[model samples]
Target: MLLTIEDLTKTFPGTVALDGVCFDLRAGEVHALLGENGAGKSTLVKCLTGVHARDSGTIWLEGKEISPASTLEAQEAGIGTVYQEVNLLPNLTVAENLTFGRQPTRFGMVSGRKMRAEAEAMLAGYGLDHVNVTRELGTYSVAVQQIVAIARAVALSGKVLILDEPTASLDARETETLFQVVRGLRERGLGIVFISHFLDQVFEISDRLTVLRNGRHITTADTAGMDRLELIHHMLGHELEEAEGRRRHRQGGVERLQVRGLARRGKIEPFDLTVREGEVIGLAGLLGSGRTETADVLFGRTPPDRGDATDADGPIDLRTPRTAIAAGFGYAPEDRKTDGVIADLSVRENIALALQARRGWTKPIPRAEQRRLANDYIRRLDIRTPGAEKAVGDLSGGNQQKVVLARWLAMNPRFLILDEPTRGIDVGAHAEILKLIGELTAQGMSILLISSEFDELIAASDRVIVVRDRRHVSELVGEEIETGRIIDAIAAHENGEGAMTP
Candidate 1:
């Protein structure tokens, strides 16, 4: 092994980010680290790169035990990392950015000519000779900037390279070009760690895989023999066979909203959907699969360039969140703490926010009405707050999530979009939220539920739409909405085949 980690543990104030995690990187191979949210992948990377100090463990480089106190120290110890976003100075020239800190100096002065020559050599070595070294980095495309970032990292540290979602922002052609560069690096005996949410890319580029779940190392296996379904099981911490017994019959409902050709550039691809009254349309996809992007467009957070949306009233313009809210649409975002809840405000104020916004600032709901609305939802949703005047931030995660839902429900919108509604909550809260979904739909409410947990989708969704690479590839209805089927649809190649390949 070129690099090895044993019993690595990292802890925060009240949570353990990594627990007895172990990983190894061999020379001339691409090893992929796989996990969902809070899986300790980021913590492990930070520990290895000296961004976060490990509470306990050992890191061995070239068979020598080493501990790096900083990123510079890690680089000097022969480890390098390139993040999804290019971290280089965009205003500076490529040559200057490459040799910014370690420029070759002459007579106590920085030598510009030597720096450009060195940068040119570095690019040529990495097959990036076409990049103009004298031009400002910001002038180039993101793909080019990403390649430049990779080249700079390799030039700085030649032994072990970590590419964190390097192809995230690139198109198909650009991703292939980046992969070619990575293959060349692996050929030169560099141990490369490739991290990405795109399973297709993982199957194509990685030689081996390490899966982490809930801060513990789950399994390490060769990527060649493992199918996407098996890998998903490891990452999601669930068994597919257990997905049976929850496939219930769907209730055919009336069409509530019709969306045609809705899309936003660089966000979600053009797609058509028909949401039905009393129906739960589940958005199923891996992280970054445009699930949230789809929700954002539907709720007018990211306005679509060209699309027609209509309700029973007639054509509706989804130009902004306010318009969407006015059109009987509501959205509870994925991140509750950041986007959903206003921590400083009391529950009464938070619940009345959307309603007040819709009614306009001048026509504020009377304080009596606000209190009534807040107390009503608090009792109905079974919110565990002591009183409506309690600060929403002080509530538990589950209660906070309920408060967000209560805020939207107070609007009495005909359609609501819930993104990861049960995530980061306790098991009791998870069950309660699922129950609430059923109850809401029973009351003729249309819902778009976005969840990573397949069981939740299977249990609550009348239809499951599988998204991949920002496109809605497959839709399963009735008996077809099973765990394996959803996984197959997600893992299917863009060529429409059920198998994934390079």
Candidate 2:
């Protein structure tokens, strides 16, 4: 084994972030660390990299007991980490950023020529010669930046490389390129720890899998013997009997919201979809399959090239989020930390933010009234915070998500677009969120739900729309919306074949 972690434990103020987690990584293996948000996956990674010292654990690197007290120590000991956010300096050229601390110098002077040459050579090894090493790193797209980060980490000569959601912002072609690089790394005998929400990518690349739930080690097994549903069940901590029971109630009603010829150039293709008034509609596809893109168009994040939405009220022109809001549309974006919540603001301020924005900043809602509204939501949604005065950032991941939902719930929208609403939350929180969606739909609200979890999409949505290659390729309703069918449709489209529709 390249690395072994035994009985690792970590605790924060009110939470046990990691509890006796054990795992092993082998050379020439891609091990996927799977879990929902706040499930100790992050803690495990931090512990491995020395970002957070573990409370108790035994870490053996190449059969030698080592406790790295800092990230630099971990790096020197041949352990590297590439986080979700790009850590390279934006102002510096790619070459300089890659060799930031350990620059090749001669006679106490940095060798720019050597740096550029080495950087270019390293990038070329990963099929990234198209990106100029001398150019500013920020000028390139996120995919290119990610590649640079990975290249830098590998160039550190690390025996184990930890990639945390490296492909979250990457497109289809970019993800393919990354997979190739990962395969190459595995071939070179590097133990890679892949962390991602995209299960298909996890299955495609990972040789072994370790699942964490609520800061506890759940299971570790070979990827080849495990199925998608089983992996999800492990991550969710759902009993087989409970899942079977839920599966029986999957089928629901007719179309509530209908979209025809929905198109957005360079975003999504002309698509058709429908969701019943009392039903949840799921958009399932790969990273750039236009799932979130379609949600953007529907919820007025972006203007569609040419498309129309028909609801009980009538056909509506959703040109912008303001117009969509006025037409009774609500949107909860994917990244709650960035797009959904205001970290600096109090819970009251954050919860009333959307309503206040819709009302226009000039005509502000009275502070007293805003407090009242916030308090009501806090009570209704069971938002866990000290008080309405607490900063939104101070709350737990699940609680912060609740505040985001409360913001939209205050709008009383007819149609709600939830883009990865349950992402980065625990199983209990996910269940609560899903239950809330079901409750809203039962009360005559139409919803467009998008999730990376196939089972979550299938379980919560009454109908499913599969997008592939930035286009809506298939629609499955009622009995047709099964995991196997959805996976088949997505795989078919991904491999250059059109999705089979029903």
Q: Among these predicted structures, which one has the highest TM-score?
A: 2
**Cα lDDT tens digits for candidate 2, 394-426:** 665557878898898877677888887765454
lDDT of 1 by residue, 1-502 (tens): 8999999999875567799999999999999987764567767888999998989999999999989999888898999999876899999999888887764444137666777887898888666767889999999878889989988889889999998767655656678889999999999999999987667789999999999877899999999989878887787666433333453545667888899888898998888999888889998887778999999998889989878799888999897998899899999886674688899999999999988998899997999999999999887766766688988866645577788988998988889999877654433345556777777888999899998778789988889999999988888888889999998888888885531111
| Clash list (residue pairs), candidate 1 | none
Q: How many backbone clashes does candidate 2 have?
A: 4
lDDT of each: 0.83, 0.80
Number of the top-ranking candidate, with lDDT as the measure: 1
* Deviation (Å) of 318 in candidate 1: 4.0
What 10-residue stretch in candidate 1 is worst by lDDT?
239-248
